[model samples]
Target: MKATTFPGMSLDIDIQELTPVQWPALEKLFGKNGACVGCWCMFWRLEEGERFQDVKGASAKQRMKALVAQGQARGLLAYVEGEPVGWLTFGPRRSFPRLDRAPSLKCDDADEVWSLPCFFIHKDFRNQGVATALLKFAMDTLRQRGVSTLEGYPVKVPAGATRVANSSAYTGTVPFFEKQGFKSVAERPQGKQRMRKSLVLRRSARKQGS
Candidate 1:
């Protein structure tokens, strides 16, 4: 993908797909905390019965690297000038096994959907539209790949609150996804929500609808 500079921003932001060669950029973006208390962005990728705490830090980082090397983990990174500043994780629904176990997110069309489960933007770049830019790029990329639907599990902040804490916003905020055309389809516990967006037009059964 080409480098893009969104309006109202002076610096150019480039979005690129994750690959082995781009691991260093991701590493630099994630920093020592692994993008939130040593998560290393492996929360949703964990298998059933796998504990996140066990692989929280360096182990989690290594596991992510392994997935990148083996071509299993998929995501996109956003860069400004030459520094990585943002990330978005997405792939086939089945690839994110944890989603299968989520009671609220369960659906019959799992096989036909792509899941976008996480995003991380550098602290310095937060609220500058980096996340929105990344999401738009991912949508375009997936649509071009013929994906018909995309899903995300974002956190819904409490009413009357103007902003959610950064930690709770990792999955993104409901308004953010709604601005991107996603609709809340189910309510999960703990203010989390299951939202979906259709990437393509569905076939009509009738020539003229009543």
Candidate 2:
């Protein structure tokens, strides 16, 4: 577990990678609504032609649990005072086949990139830097694992707006990604953006340096 304390915040935040052992914490965090209409953070993992409504409730929860059991799902959970308050899911681009169907969001180096597709923070924890802390931890963890690049698809809050509904910000906000050193690489319709960040020096670059 990684502990972090943000500026102006008194509570210490502990972040841990999601594992089968941490399943109960995730369950508590997602609550009965399944973190936005029973998504359970599985929207991006949906297969082609799969209707979300078909899996919106218990089915989606089961699928996510199965992924957790098989170690196919990757994510981070943040805790404050031992309560899970935030979550972020990321993995190899191919893990989220739905991205391929997203118009104009495909990248040339898909095989080499990891994607951060979902974030959910407890209602009481919103705007408290929990997501920022979770994101920073994920970048560090991914970098140590030899992931050179990371990408995010965050919703763009309209100009002059301070905030959007929690549902609208499920993927995160463009400004948040920009603050974390991600640069806008492509645009998706509906005010969404494809952003990219280099997490580590490429293997070739490191070899040349050595």
Candidate 3:
């Protein structure tokens, strides 16, 4: 299948594998609010309580830059006409400390699954179906890397709940997951629930507990 191209922004987006050079563009896309203030997304990547002071301002920004310097292509970027307008952070489950420690985000299968940690789409591009596209691109990118499964923690909203800040986890909405072929594989006591989609690549021997 061909990759998507949103031409309004002259969106000749090259959804290539992310690298160190791309992190700055990712940061710029996140902007002064840290894509929603104080969350360089180190919340899940940092030790508990260690972020209280560092995750705000320049401190948190620096830390993430260091990770990039270490060659961590934590996620993918949607470059439109050469300017980064979207970002999605996804990687190995264990790589993100917060999700692994979260009550329900934990996985039942031990096949070394990759998880869609979250997203940070620019505010202007919020309603443009960018998040869903990012999800698909992330899956395809990891598919080539040989991931057996992919999972995400989208906010589970019911019929009458009011809309809240998009930054809440920037994880995403449950309906979005359903659209992406993800089903409720696990539920959390809190509103945040784990949604997953199994990749059609290599099968896990772990699937059958012989």
Candidate 4:
């Protein structure tokens, strides 16, 4: 378990990558609704087809499980005092088939580029820095794994907007990505902006400063 602490918060936050054996923890975190719309974090991973619509809840869960079984980078779960509270979905850009059709979002030619497609934080943990902690953990983990770049598709929303639901913010807010050192590289026609971070450059800078 990787732990981080913040001032005034007594408990340490731990984030961990999911394995087939830890599926139960994710099941417990997502609960009965399957993390909204029976997605199971398979929204971008699968192509849009009748089969996709047909596999609503349980089937979607199985599909994600099968991906996890493939042994590639799937995502990480955040735990506070041993209870799972948040999730971040990330992996090779091509692993998500739907990206090919996404307007204004295209993968670069680099083989080591990864994409962060979504985030889900439990209701109780919202605005508590859990997502930020998870993001930091993910950056370090990916850098150590030799990822060249990281990309994200976050929504461009007005500041302090309460009209949006938590579920809709799954793609993440632009400010959140900015705080993580990601810069806007492009924007979609529909207002979803693409952000990129060069892990390779950051690593080089850190080493130089050291």
lDDT of each candidate versus the true structure: 0.88, 0.88, 0.72, 0.79
TM-score of each: 0.91, 0.90, 0.83, 0.87
For candidate 2, give the lDDT.
0.88
- Model 3 over residues 14-104: C-alpha lDDT tens digits? 4545688777787788788777666776767876666546566677788888888796647777766677877788888877877766766
Off by over 4 Å in 3: 1-14, 48-54, 188-190, 201-210
Candidate 2 residue-wise lDDT, 43-131, digit = tens? 98999999898988999999999999898999999999889999999999999988888876788888999999999999999878899
Error of 4 at 161 (Å): 3.9
Model with the higher TM-score, candidate 2 or 3: 2
**Over 4 Å off, model 2:** 1-10, 188-190, 201-210
Worst 10 residues of 4 by lDDT: 1-10
- Candidate 1, residues 1-210, lDDT tens digits: the string is 344555655456788888888899999999999999999889988998999889799999999999988979899999887899999999999999988898877889899999999999999999888999899999988987999899999998887888889989999999899999999888654577999999985456223432
For model 2, give the RMSD to the true fold: 3.2
How do these models rank on TM-score, best leading? 1, 2, 4, 3
Better of 1 and 4 by lDDT: 1
